[model samples]
Each structure stands twice: as structure tokens, then as C-alpha cells.
Target chain A: MMLLQATGLVAGYGRPVVGPVDIALHRGEVLGLAGPNGAGKSTLLAALAGSVRCFAGSILRAPGVALSWQTQRQPAVAGIPLNGRELLALTGAAPAGLPPWLASRLEERLDRLSGGQLQFLHLWACLQAPAEVILLDEPTNNLDPDGVAALAAAIAQRAAAGAGILLVSHDERFVTATCQRQVLLKGAAES
Target chain B: MNVELLFDPLFLWPCLTGMVFALLLPLCGAYLRLRGEWLAALSYAQMAAAGGLGAMALGWPLALGGPAAAFLAAGVKNVFEEAAESVRGAAYAMLLLAGWGVAVLLAANLPLAERLGHALSDGQLYFTDQGHFFAALGALAVALPALAGLSRPLLLSHFYPDFYRARGRSARRLHLAFDLLVAGVLALATTGIGVMAAFALVFIPPLAAAPWAGSWRRALVLGGGLGVFAHLLAFALALVLDQPYGPVLALLLVALGAGSALLAQGHSRIAK
Candidate 1:
């Protein structure tokens, strides 16, 4: 069944930065959104997440659908002091399938983690959340090879469990390997 | 040392009030520090001080004017939702300076202006009246549970507001509510303990506890405990050495904060 459908959706912060684009996400499908900088890849995700204003078109979600979004920028964790496990727990995300390296360091402070470590931990946080639709922006940024493999595995696991994922990434190899389908966002003017 | 003075009715209320302030202020402070808005406390406190002084000059109650001024200042920030960061910083600076300027100007005509200014800036906890005491108690009653209830969401908002928003939570409202609470607490505290003491109590203990804490919850608990200990210790030292309570307490809190930072450094080194 279709989990989320965006029909001729136009979205932006202001002045219509991206879209009039169409996309549909189905259960168990991984859709990759690939674009260059300023192509509104993040903006499109924001539209899906209901953060940006939709100037045109409609996004229809299945009844009672929950969404999880991981923005591109790593949240400022310097003073937060939350650990990986605590973060998952707070979001009601189960820690059962977290990568062993991350699972072992669940008690370590978020701020103390290496950039790659923190990135994957945050990705897991979104992936594990109980949601029908997941939106991840640049999920592979700062990730090492091992971390990327872990993430790809986790994504497959979530898809196997019937979750729909809308992933935005610039890494062609990761997207080619992970996503079942891909959508390319051109600059707003081009679109 | 006159030990009996500690048990005096005049001292009893201040001590009780101090304990209550210690409990709530550090919790608020830790959260503020987490949000990187620690300066909000000082800015709000100064606005409250100006309000109280202005009200006194106009023959109104200090309490009414103080919190009103603080709420107004906090509201101003909310109003300028789209203001740039530099603009917001400039606004805070201007509010603080203007508040202090108005306070000084108002006090100029009064005979005890210099002393009153000193009390507002340095604090005069022992001189707090019953009204101010009850106000602090009331603020504590409201702040403690409110903070406890909002702690998780507040923490989430501080670190990942976008995530909080994705969860269908209103991050902006949560921020405004937290800011209002801080402003209210500061307003009451400024009236009772003075701005200097309020700022110290709200900022120092939380900072002291942060380096040692593994989590935000632990930091708040540790900071609250540290605040209370500092308050009581300073009160005792004031009695022993015949010094004013506020300045001594502020100085001691700073000392404790420094000590904790050093201890945390040593602890980290040992672990490494």
C-alpha cells in the first residue's frame, strides 16, 4: 500500500525553493532523493516532514502514519549530555538492532562520540523510531565504511519490516546499493 | 560567632527561601546552559531590577513591576521571532543597558540610591521582606514541577528541535514557555535575593555540575544540591565572619564551580 504520496508538490522556505515535483512512497520501498547542492533535496524532505510550507500540490499519508526525519546537520550535542541509549529510549525507539559498536557505547555521552559515531547513532535513532515513513538527509555524511555498512543493513532491516524510507544522499554508490528507486531533484528553477 | 542569630526569625525566612531558590534555580540554569541561553538570566534579572526600582519610584509594589518588566522583555524576544542572531544579541545588550540606565536614573533622586543600587546588583538576601519571600516560594512551587514535567521535551528541544518538531511537538512554544519560566523565576529572585545572587545561583551551580555529570538529569540534580550546599555554607560563613550574605554566597558559589571544573578535569585525565 502507498504509505505517502506527494502529487505535484511545491514546497519552500519562502519564494518556492523546490518542487511541483511528484513522488509516491510505498510500504517496504526505499526511495533515494539525489541532487546537487541548492537543488532543494533537504527542502523536499522538509516538505515530506511537514516542516516547509507546501505552496502547491498535496501530500497524502496513510491514516495514522507517523514520520521520522533526520536532518542533514548534526544536532549540536556539545552540552546536551544525552547518551545513545537514552536518546533511543526517549524517542521510544528500540535498541535491539543497533550496530554492536554503537550498542556497546550507548552509555557514552553524545558529545563525546566521534563525528562518524554520532552520525550513525542519530541515523539509528530515526530508523528505529516507530514510524511508517522515515526521511533521512545526507545520512552517510561523516560515516566510515563500517558505519555505512551498518546503516545500509539497518535500512534494509527497516524496509523488511514494511517501513517506507525517503533517503536523500549525494553518495551515488550508497544510494545505488540501498535504494530500490531514486528521484533526482533539480534546482527549483529547473524544476 | 553569634550562633543564635542563625535561628532568629529574620534569618529563618531567608534561609528557607534560599533553600527553595537553590532547588529550582540550578535546574533552570542547567537547562538554560544546555540551550546556550544562560545570558537570558542576567538580562531578565536586570530588567526585573529596573522594573522594581521604577515601580518603587512610582509608589507601586516592587513585585508587580519586576515580573511584569521581565515578562515584557521575554515577550519582546518572542515578538522578534525573525530577528537575526546579531539583532537579538544587540536587543539583549540594549535591554540590559537600558534597564540599568533607567534604574540608575530613577534612583538618582532617592536618598539611598547608591545603597539600593548596591542591593539590587550585589543582593541583600537577609533584607528580603515577607512578600518577596512568599513570591519566591510561589515561584518555586510553580517552577519545580513545571521543570520536572517539561524536562524531557525541553532537553529534546535544546538538542534537536527539528526532531521534536517532527514528533508533532511545538518547539517554539516549548522554548517560549521555558523562557517565560526563567524570566518569572529571575524576576522573583531579583526582588528577593538581588540580581547578583539570582544570576550566581542560576548560572554557577549548573556549570559546576556539568563537567562531572554524564547526563542532563544528573547535572541538574548535582547542580541543585551544590546550590543548596553553597547557600547554607555561605549563610554560615556570613554569620561567622560578620559579612553580607549575598556577595559572600556569590563568591563561594563561584569557588565551588571552579573547584568542580578542576575536579572534572582531573577525573577525565584519570579516566584517559
Candidate 2:
């Protein structure tokens, strides 16, 4: 089922940074937006998340649909007393499906965890949220091999559970293995 | 020690008032610290003082002047919040200076305003009347439940900001409402506890407990508990030492802050 549809989308900050493009996300499917640096790949995700301004075009969501966005760069959380389990709870993401690698460390403060471990926890939270649409920007950054496998399995499970996911990532192999379709941009679309 | 004075009926209202402020300040302070706008406590307090003085100068009752000016300050910051599309912290610095400047100006022009200013700055907890005790009671009644309702979304707004924007909703409105609530509480706190003492209750407890909290609930617990503890201790010490409540409260918190900082150095929250 079509969960979200954007028609003739033109998205950007104040000026156009991406699109004059089109995309739609459907339940039970994973969509990949693949492109070079500055191709507005991240901007596209921001537009969909409604963080950046949308200059033109329209995004339509089916009634009562919810979304989760995992941004490309998270704000500094160091020295904050929040732990991984509490962080997950913010998104209403439970720990039931978290891989053992991260599950064992959920009790530790987020700042105390290593980079790859922290990255995986963030991904897991968004992937596991109750939202039907998940937008992930460079979700693979800082992730190790085991973390990647866990993420792949998670994506499959969430999609099977009727989620529609749109992700922007530079990890070509991860994208090829997980996404059934890829939309590639030839040149930089951010102006 | 003048510990007996704490139970004196003449001092009953002041002690009750002090205890009520102890509860109200830290609860609101936790959210202010969470939002990184702890300065709002001082800014709102100054604006209230300025508002009260401005009312005095114009022959208006303080009750009419203080909240009205604070409401304007909250509204101004809310407008800044919308224009900037950022958190309320962005506009607080400017508001702080403006409020202070207006207060100084108004205080210089009116002798009564000047006395009130001195009373506001030097601490008036010992002199808080029955009305002030009731005001503190009313503030506690209003602020505690409101802060509880605002906690979740504010936390989520900090951790997962896109959650609101994605739904085509803005956190600015949430911020404005919170600012107005905070302004009301801070105004009452300023009038009862004096500005420095009120600011201490609002800033110190939250900062001291922030590094120790493993969860949001724990953060609030530690912060609120610390606030009440330090406040009651300060109140007793001020009475015993024949010191003004404001400086004594500020000094005790500074002592607590020094202790907290030292303790944090040896502490580790990492699980095996």
C-alpha cells in the first residue's frame, strides 16, 4: 500500500538544493536514494522529514501515517547522563529486538559507548519505532560488520512488518543487498 | 543557634514560603536546564522586578504590573522563537540584558522602587507575608503538574527534534507555552525568595545532578531532591547565622556545587 507520495518535488533550504524529482514509498518495501556527495541526498531526506524548507511540490501521506527520521549528524550527546535504553525509549522504541551486541550495553551511558555501538543503537531505535515510515540518512556511518548484519536483518523484519523505509546511504554494498530498487542522481542537485 | 525561630509563629509564613519556593524552583529549573535555557530563570525574574517597579512608578498595583510585563517578555521571546525557528534559548540573552536595564532605570527613578529592588536583590524570604506564602502555594499548585505534562515532548524535542517537524508541527508553540509557565513561576519565586536565591534554586540543583542521572526520571529526582535539600538547609543556616536568606542560599549551593563536582570526578556510571 502506498504510504507516502511526493509529486514533482522541488525541495531545498531557501534556494533549491534538490529535486524537480518524484518518489513514493509503500508499505512492505525499502527504497534507496543513492547519489554522489552534494547531490542533495541528505537534503531530500530532510525535506521529507520537514526539517528543511520545501520550495515547491507536495508530499502526501495516507491518513494516520507516522514517521521516524534518523538524521545524518546527531547533536553532541557527550556528558549527558542519558543511557542507551533511555535513548531508545524516547522514540517509543523497545529493546526486545535489539541485537545482543547492543542489548548488553543498553544500561551504559550513551557517551560511554564506542562510536560504532552508539550508531547502531540510534539506527535500531528508529527502525524499531512504531512508525510506518522510517527515513534514515547515512544510517550505516560508523557501523561495524556485525552491526551491519544486524541492521540488514532489522530492515527486512520491519519491512515485513509493513513499514515503508526511505534511506540515503553511501554504503553501496549494503544498499545493493537490501534495497530492491535504487534511485541514483547523476550530478549535484544542490545549488 | 536560632533553630527555635524556625518554629516561631512570627516566622511561620516565611518558612512555609521558603519551603514552597524550594519545591517550585527546582522542578521548573530541571526543564530549563534540559532546554539549556537556565538563564531564563534570571531573565524572567529580572523582568518581573522591572514589571513590578514599572507598575509602582505608574501607581499600578504590583500584582497587575509584574505578570503583565512577564507575559510581554514571554510573548516577545515566543515571537523570537518563531522567527528564528530555534529553541527559546536563542532569545534569552538579549531579553536578560533588556530586563535588567529596564529594572535599573526604573529603580533609579522611584525611591519606593529602589527599596523594592534592594528587597528583591538582598532577599525577602524572612519578610514574606501571609499573602506571599499563599502565592507560593498557588504557584506550586500550578507549576508542578504543568511541568510534568511538558516533560516528555520537551525531552523528545531535544533528542529527536525531527519528530515534531515531520508531523508538520513546530516545537516553538510548545516552547512559548513553557516559557509563559516558567515566567509565572520565576516571577513568584523572585518576589518570595529574591532573585539570586531563586536563580540558585533554579540553576544549581539541576546542574549538580545532571551528570549523575542515568535516566530522565532520575535526573528530575536528583535535581528536585537536591533543590529542596539545599533550600531547607540554607533557610535554617540563614536563620541560625542571622544572615540574609539570599546570599546564604547562594553560598550553600555553591558549596554543594563544589562538592558535586568533586564527587563526579571519582564516580563512574558505566555498567559491566
Candidate 3:
């Protein structure tokens, strides 16, 4: 089941930042996008998510496909005065599957949570959402070892449930350990 | 203080109208503050007031022209917001200035419009009739369910703006719809309560409640409760003290904001 295919994609803010490359994601598989800083890995994800301009490319998604995207380093939701539980509800994710470490503190404000806990809770919302396609940008930024492992488990579970997942992160080990397939995006200059 | 006067037929309708806005406008305010588009309240209110004046000059009803112009302003604002996030504040300022400019020119030329403008500026809520009272209720009726239904996407958009566009949906339409609802509500409010009072209801109470609230739902209720408290207090204070409703309401809200800020600061300090 090919869920998404992007051919010769070139995306950027106003100019090409990434691609002239090809990638395909299938149901029940995690595809990792890796590169150094400024490699446009995030840009490629944005292009696929339609949040950025695609100068040239055709992205074909299977009929009735929907995307759930979690962007990099969102401003701390601490300022929002919402708790983890409220965030999950708003994102349409359930707490039933939450790890016990997180489930106990769902009532606390997001700002009160440590960085890794907050990041993990945010990641869980996207992972648990009922979307055919999931796009994650730097999901491992502040996660501790436990949080990272929890994320890896959730990713696998989501994949098993038939989502086509696109993962972008600088944590090479996490990516290498988690994704079934990997794509390296050379920066626009090298590409 | 002659409390019985508040229930007098003459004052009852306007008081009821204020109560309706007190409860409803804060919901719009919370979302506006969340979206960082609080300036839209002033933009929409001023534009609607200007539009009302323009309608009066043309010998037509002010209500129709007010919302019509607000919707138009919402379109213009949409263009600016779409261009970049950085310019949202600038767009709101521009809209406010344009409305102020047009309103000044219209008032200068039309004698009748000048009087109406003063009444609108003074926020003569006491003079509001049954029609104005019902309109406030009507705005409340439309805004509540609409805000409730739009809560998910609106909340998501605030948290992760890319969520909807990634799902291949135009986040702008949701924004514009919200803007239009605010504009309509503010338009009716501006006509009843005056610009500053209307904007106050949409600004201060939510602000006062946000700091203490533990959840989004609680903040909403607290904000509404605060708005009602302020409105009734301002209404009573104005009646007893012989002050005008608009200025009194605006002052009451400012006091609330400042008091809340002080308390929140003290709490933070105590925790430290």
C-alpha cells in the first residue's frame, strides 16, 4: 500500500531549499529523513505537508489520505495554560495508551512539565491521532532516554496500525533505530 | 445607591444587553488573545462604528452598514495576515487608522452623523432600546455555538499552526470565519456599549482570568464570570456615581487587569 509518493520535489520558503529527489512511504513503514543542519530535511517534510512552497514536484497521496504534522520546537505550550490532558483531547488523541509516567501528570500544566516530558506528550498526541500519514519534525529534541524509548514504541505501534510515517530528526541513533527505511536529503547546494 | 433603578423598565433592557455581552465577548477574547490577534477587536469595532456613521450619512440603518463594512475589513485583514505573521499587528493598526480616518471625515461633513458619532463614542448603553437588547442576545446566540464548534481547529491552529494546512485545509478560512464572528459581535456591541467598552469586554476579563486558570475551559468560565462581575459593578457604580457607562466600564476593566497582574506577580514572587 503506497500511501504517499513525492517525485523530483523542490521546496523552500521562496526558493528551492531541498530536493530534485524521490521518496515513497507505504502503510506500516516508518521512513526516516536525516541530514545535517541546513540540509532541508524539514523543508521536504513541509513540502509534503503543503505548509511550504513546492517549486516543482508531484506528491501523490492515496485516496482519502490525511496528514498529521508535528513541527519542530513549538513555543512552550506553558504559556497556553492548558494541561497535557486538554492538549490530547484537542488533538483528538486519547490518554488510554499513555505511559504511566505521563498519565499520572496529565493534570499538570504543560509549562510545569520538564522539557522532555512536554516533548513526549506533544509527540504522543500526533502519534496517537487517527491519520493515514504522520509527519514528525525533530520529535527527539529534548526527550530523555525513557521518553525517546516511549516514542519509539508508539511509532512502531502506529506503523503496525497501518500509518505511513515520515520521521525527521537530528538524533541519528533514534532515527536509525526506529525507521524501517531512511532518506538523506543533501542540502540544496549539494543536491 | 438606588439599586431599584437598575430594574426600572428604562434601564432593564440596556442592563440585560450588557450582561449578554459580558458573558459572550470574553469567549471571543480568549481565542483572540490565544491567536495573538487581540488587536482585531479594536480594528473590527472601529471599522463597524465608522461603517455605521457612513450608513447614517446615507440615510440608511446603521446596523446593516456596520457589519457589511466589518466583513469587508475582515477580507482586507485576511490579505495582510496571509502575507506574513509579523505584520498581523501592523495590519490591525492600519485597519484602525483607516476606520478612524473615514469616520472623522464623515462626521465633519454630516451634521446628523456627528451627533450619532458622539453617542456611539460616549457608549450610551442607557439609551439602548429593545432592538439593541435583542441584537446583543442575537450576537451571543451566534458566537457561542460557533466558537464551540470551531474550538478544536482553532485550538490546534494556535498550538501547531501547520496542522490544518498539512491536512490540506485552508487555515485562513477558519481564521476569517472567526474574524467575521468577532466583527459582527463587536459591531453590535460598539453600537450598544461604545467602542472602548466593547473592546474592554473582549480584552480585560479574559486577560484577568488566564493567569489563574489551570485549564482552557476554566479560563473561559472565569473570564466570562469576570466580565459579568465587571459589567454589573461598572453599571451600578456609574448609576450611583453619575458617571457614564462607557468610561466607567473601561476604567473598571483596566483596574481589573492591573489588579490581576499585581496578584499574579505576587504569587510568582511568593513561589520563588
Q: Can you tell me which runs of candidate 3 are displaced by over 4 Å?
A: A76-78, A188-191, B1-3
Q: Mind giving the per-residue lDDT tens digits that candidate 2 earns over B1-272?
A: 77788777888789889888877787788877766678777888888878877888899987777777778888887776655424556577777788889888878887888899888766788888999999888888888888888876777787777765775666888888898998888777777887788889998887888778886678778888888888788888888878888998899998998888877875653333
Top candidate on lDDT is 3
Which of the CAPRI classes, incorrect, acceptable, medium or high, describes model 1?
A: medium
lDDT of 2 at B18: 85
Clashing pairs in 1: none
Taking all chains together, the TM-score of candidate 1 against the true structure is: 0.93
lDDT of 3 by residue, A124-174 (tens): 888887799999999988888888888999999899999989999888899
Error of 3 at A191 (Å): 9.3
Tens digits of per-residue lDDT for model 3, B1-272: 67677667788888899899889889899999888888889888889889999999888888888888788888888887666656878888999998888888888898988887877767878988889888888788888999999888888877777876776667889888888888888888888888889899999998999889988899999999999999999998898777899999989899999999899989989987
Model 1 Cα lDDT, one tens digit per residue, A13-123: 867888879999999999999888988989988888888899889999999889988887667787565677778776668989788888888888888899998888888
lDDT digits (tens) for residues B1-272 of candidate 1: 78788778878777878778877889899888876667778889999988888788778887788888999888876665457767777777777887888888877877665566677877777876676668788888898899988887876665556677887888778778988999999988886678888899999999888776787667778989999999999988897778988889899998998888788789879989
Candidate 2 chain B, which ten residues in sequence have the lowest lDDT sum? B81-90
Best by DockQ: 3
- Give lDDT per model, in order: 0.84, 0.82, 0.86
